[model samples]
Target: MKKSIFGILTFILFSMNTFAQNTVAEEIKTLSKDKWQWMADKDVDKLGKLFDDQSMFVHMGGSWGKERELEIIKTGFIHYKKADIHEVFTPIIIENTVILLNRITLFAVVANTEVSNPFMVTEVYVKVGNEWKMGSLSFSKLMGPN
Candidate 1:
């Protein structure tokens, strides 16, 4: 019957859309994990490509632009030692923008001393010509034990 066919088509379309969203979420999640590793390793070149030219980064100490962020990583001003990711939630805000929320225990070396802290990191990625570039990174310090 016509109704039965229409129902099937609708279900198929909905399923496909859900699948695509999941795919994008997974891709962004992987990229986020890779970004943590790259930061730990001080891979500025890779980070530069992943970060948009006008990207903004907000840290507990201060906020800065993409170039300054990269420079800090390169100069060991705030070396990322490790990121113990507790959870990652990726939500597609629009067709071209995805917001990734990461709960993590971040270890870093600052002033030649090691420190660990819990943080909720918000990362916004925007699609640009078939590539996703990080547009913003904001770290919110979490209270209590790390």
Candidate 2:
């Protein structure tokens, strides 16, 4: 009787943990999707709250921190006109941090010239207090068509 009860309790605990993990993963996925839209809209106020103070952004041209990135977006220097997302892979969670990879075709204007390019965008989110803040955003251009 004791062994049976213990086994059942262990199974229940494991199931609950798994469900919680899945829930968090889905939340992060939704947050990432919203982030893309925010970038397109140039909504710095919203983006600022989502991004960590020391967050880093990496691009083909250069790498910069949160404030500079927000400034660039606000100024329309590199307008994120649109993002054609191909896939958003399941995120890997390490304690309080989640790492997600997104395959997308980005449409944007740089130097007043419009361009479209396939890219694998890596996004890292860190849980802060009760909220999740973006810790890093990096773009890796993919070869050929998606």
Candidate 3:
């Protein structure tokens, strides 16, 4: 009876661990898609919610603050009439409380000077308490026809 009880407890613990990993993976996917949607709609406030207070963005041009990124959307320096994100791949790496999300986002800009640029992106997330906060996000442009 004790052996059976131990086996059940072990099974439960393993199941919980698997569930946690799956949940984090799903959250990463959702956040990634939401980011593209926010960019397309130029939603600065929504975008701000996804970033950490100390979030740093390194664009193809250079680096910028999370606030600065929001400002660009607010000021209309970057505008997207419609941006379709395709061929997205997200890989999650978890080490205790730290999670790393690697993504490849292929997108076509419906409007803007920078159009048809496909990107392979990487983002890092840190689990702070019960919340998963994005610590760092970066991207590289892929050379191809878009």
Candidate 4:
């Protein structure tokens, strides 16, 4: 009887832990989706808050830190006109960090020239205290159609 009771308790504990992780993952997904919109709109204020102080951004042109990225967006240097998300892969959570990949077709204006490209965007978010902050964002160009 004790063994059976112990087994049930263990299963219950495991299930609850899984549910909590799933909830956190869902929150991360929602935040990522909102981030895309914020980028499109060039909402620097919100982006500034989402991004960590030591955040890094990688692009086809080059890589930069949070301040430079914000400057680029604010000045219309690389206007993220739109992002058509093709797929959002399952996020991998490791303790307080989450890594997510998104396949997307990005339409943007760079140097006053409009262009579109397929890319795999990788985003890393780290939970700090009770909030999640973006630590890294990278764009890898894909050779294919949208």
Candidate 2: segments with Cα more than 4 A from true spot: none
lDDT agreement of model 4 with the native: 0.95
lDDT of 3 by residue, 54-84 (tens): 8887667678878887887776666644435
lDDT of 4 at 43: 99
Q: What is the lDDT of residue 61 in candidate 4?
A: 95
Off by over 4 Å in 1: none
For model 3, what is the C-alpha lDDT against the true structure? 0.67
| lDDT assessment of candidate 2 | 0.96
lDDT of 1 by residue, 1-146 (tens): 99999999999999999999999999999999999999999999999999999999999888999999999999999899999999887575688999999999999998788999899999999999999999999999999765
lDDT of 2 by residue, 1-146 (tens): 99999999999999998998899999999999999999999999999999999999999999999999999999999999999999999999999999999999999988788999999999999999999999999999999889
lDDT of each: 0.94, 0.96, 0.67, 0.95
Most accurate candidate by TM-score: 2
Q: Flag the better candidate by lDDT, 2 or 3.
A: 2
**Descending-TM-score candidate ranking:** 2, 4, 1, 3
Candidate 4: tens digits of C-alpha lDDT, residues 1-146: 99999999999999999998899889998999999899889999999999999999999999999999999999999999999999999899999999999999999999899999999999999998899999999999999676
Give the CA lDDT, 0 to 100, for residue 77 in model 2: 91
The clash count for each model shown is: 0, 0, 0, 0
Clash count (model 1, backbone only): 0
Which pairs, if any, clash in model 4?
A: none
Candidate that would win on lDDT: 2
> How do the candidates rank by lDDT, highest first?
2, 4, 1, 3
Candidate number with the higher lDDT (2 or 4): 2
Q: How big is the positional error of residue 100 in model 1, measured in Å on the Cα after superposition?
A: 0.6
